[model samples]
Target: MRSVEEHQAVVDGLLPAMPAETVPLAEAHGRVLARDVVAQVPLPGFDNSAMDGYAGRWAELAAADGSPVRLPVAEDIPAGRTDVVPLAPGTVHRIMTGAPLPPGADVVVPVELTDAGTEVVEIRARPPIGSHLRAAGEDIAAGTMALSAGAPLAAAQLGLAAAVGVTELSVRSRPRVLILSTGSELVAPGRPLARGQIYESNSVLLAAAVEEAGGIPRRLHFVPDDVDQFLATVRAELAGADLLVTSGGVSAGAYEVVKDAFATLGTVEFGKVAMQPGGPQGAGTVDGVPVVTLPGNPVSAFVSFEVFVRPALRRALGHASPHRLRAPARLTSSLRSPAGRRQFLRGRYDAGEVSQVGGPGSHLVAHLARANCLVVVPEDVTELPAGAAVDVVLIEGALQ
Candidate 1:
């Protein structure tokens, strides 16, 4: 049996680095930047107000000592006003938030500090000079790097790009993954199941996983356990697919159509890894497209994807950190694992403590859904008592 690390390396090496493509800023969210994005113009391109108030010279307000100083409101300035004139020597301008500051105005007295008026206003208090003014180039300067290469674009980053007049961004292209699941006893959900047939769910699970990992997923209908038919179905859909992912049929069973069909081609290899719930694995090429075969059980398929395929896809997409965040957590209860295989148990992690969610069963999809983390038990250890510190791979909110 191959160790888990060996199989991980083999699977990760299957796909080459993806090339970059220019996409509209709207579509670039969740994609990794291929090149540094520079600011086309400085943030806050013009001096603007940070508050709704009156703009005037600080000297006029301070001349009143502790008494209220009244000034004529020369003009009312709202946001988006382009035809702004400098403030007269002794008059003030009524300004709203984000409105450009007039040339001679050096301070803003918040509306709350002055009598709210349109034609004339009374300033009750004096504020420091240059207060409540957003200076041009204060946030970021023009021609400087706004976002660096290898950064993942999100809402804030996209907003910044838009602020700097960036309409398009160069990002790593998402890999197109063709996904399928195999089994003779499998039937689609929402259909009545016969005595022996069960609902097929691996395809849905793996397809969502692929998309969550930043790969484009095209899910093929679940194929039956016939070697010739399986080979034909896969080869037909292999066009334009960068990677092929299938679940089931690679295990040691009599009618393992995936292993049987791919073995005949002499390109794909099948083996077992020293990991519980997802030991059976395969990786190779079919018609020049990379393929990764995972065990059919829903939990197993999900775990295998998290362990192997997710990182590989993220790496191809140029993500700097492709793996899940792992941290040490104290166990709330005892657990046992097989002697020679590493175990990844569904777990709930909170505040430095992790508790097992359910028994280590591959078919317990409900338990898997309730888990926010995976409690990893190494191969050398068989039993871990309560309060023992073990590593946990955090999953909740980790995709971002």
Candidate 2:
């Protein structure tokens, strides 16, 4: 048995970080940027109208009220057209939204205050110093750092790239993951279960975990308890996936296929910690691909995924901070755990205080589902009185 920190240290050194690649900005969503994104071109590119109004010098508008003004709609500047003609002296251009401002124009007046009283078809709103205008380099000047490396691309980022004339960007590539669910009594969902059979939910769950960590799951191979079958399947799958994730078969049971196979190849080391549910753990390289073997219990499997595997996968995909968030909060009730092991207690958080939500047992699956947090109880503390300060990892924070 190893301490939680010990095993975590072991898992940390298992895999190296992955590299980056260039991807289209449209496809950059959900991917981490490898390099800083500098704005090659200014946002809006040039001075343009932010609204449909008239363009004139601000000094000219301040000069007089109802000053007779006549200016041609120079070149009828629409969006995406660069051919801008200068504004004729003492004339206003009938500009539309997003149209480039004509040269020698400093202000825009909306078509509202014409007071011409239907005397003319195009009424000009007068006496506005600065109205309906977007200045050049107002949003972003050229050569500015728009986004930094390691930032995840969002919708706004994509729009920024498009605005800066960047159709594609370089980003970290998604890690390749292979899922292995080992059990003889396991059957995929949508099938009839035999007397001792259970549905194969680990692969699906593990695949989702990998996806959340920015990994591309290559394949999910189901292996039975037999050693020969397990070894064959894992060896075959490892050829493609950069990381191999296996659920179950790592526990200390007489018929544990993962332990049995690892005994011969020495590719995995089975051990336990003081944590609830996710006690049994194993890790090593199988056919040159990093392998993480989790306990069979569903809650244990998921906990192990969050605690160890998710961070590794995230680092492999180039994320800055890959682990779950741990925050300080007062415990609502007392909790107990083993003498020399760190415990992750299933919990719920409300009003900024976290409380243990489930019985202190490892196999309690329903309790985990009802829980939104994992209250961290460190080793060496026997009992925690109600209202004691403890660290908690929120599965979902309260809606702000």
Candidate 3:
């Protein structure tokens, strides 16, 4: 059997970086930057007050004795006021937060330090020169790089771009992924189930996982265990797809539609990896589009995507950190893994302590749903005792 890393390397080799596209600033959040975001204009475009206070020269307020110095408020400046004149030499300006500092003003004394006066303010404290003033380009200078390439655009990043006068951004395009789940005995949810039939859920699970990984998922209807029909369905849906992910029909079963359909293509490789929940794996191309086949069980399929597909999607999307955050946590209970397979058990982690949520079974979807992390055990180690420090991949919550 191939090791987990070996299978991952194969998947990585199949995916190339996606091309970049221009998107409006409103749609750029959660996307990856394709190029460096250089500032066209400096942040704070003009010098502004950082607080609601009085703007004046420092020399007029400085006194050897700690006494109140009252100055006539020469002007009242609120945010968005455009007609700003230079400060009178002996007077101060009552300024609101984010209002432009008039020319010739060197410092601002906060309102709390003086009586709340609109006409004439008494400045009780001596503020240092240039205090409470936000200088132009202090945060970012014009023509300087504001955000580097390969960084994920979050609220703060988008705000920074807007601050630098960027209306649109070039970002890596989200990959279009076609998701297919195959099983003759599987029926869609909300439909009547006959004897020997189960609800089809892999497509829904995989689609959500694809979206979370920054891929646009298109879920095709579940195909039965007929090779001819599966091939027809896949061929019809291959257009415009960057990646194809099929759940089920790759295992060594009597009716393995995916294996039987693609085995003769010579491009796909179907094999097993040394992992407990997601052992059966397949990677290849179908009509020039990359394909990955995962096991049929819901938990197994989810785990496979988490272990392999998510990283490849993130890397193609130009994310700098393509892997899930992993941390070490002490186990609260003992567990034994399979002798030769690495185990990824559903776990509940809190305050640095992690406990297995359920048995190491591939069909425990409910337990998987409640889990916040996956406790990873190496292939070489079969048994672990309580208090053992194990590496865990955070799946949800604040840490993730």
Pitting candidate 2 against candidate 3, the one with the higher TM-score is: 3
lDDT of 2 by residue, 96-196 (tens): 68889998888776656443222222344454555778888989999999988777787887788788888888898787888878888888889899899
Native-to-model Cα distance after best TM-score fit, residue 225 in candidate 1, in Å: 1.9
**lDDT of all predictions:** 0.92, 0.76, 0.92
**For candidate 1, what is the total of clashing residue pairs?**
0
lDDT of 3 by residue, 1-400 (tens): 9999999999988899999999999999989999999999988789999999999999989861289887889999999999999999989999999999999999988999999788888788887888999999888889999999899999999999988889999999999999999889989899999999999999999999998889999999976567787788798899999999999989998888999999868789999999989999999998899999999999999999999999999999999999999989999999998889989999988899999997888999988988999999999998999999999999963224
> Candidate 2 at residue 197, lDDT?
89
lDDT of 2 at 200: 79
User: Predicted candidate 1: what Cα RMSD to the true structure?
Assistant: 2.6
TM-score ranking of the models: 3, 1, 2
Preferred candidate (lDDT higher): 2 or 3: 3
TM-score of 2: 0.81
Q: Which candidate number would show the highest TM-score if scored against the true structure?
A: 3
My TM-score estimates for the predictions, one after another, are 0.92, 0.81, 0.95
Model 2 deviation from the true structure expressed as Cα RMSD, one decimal place: 4.1
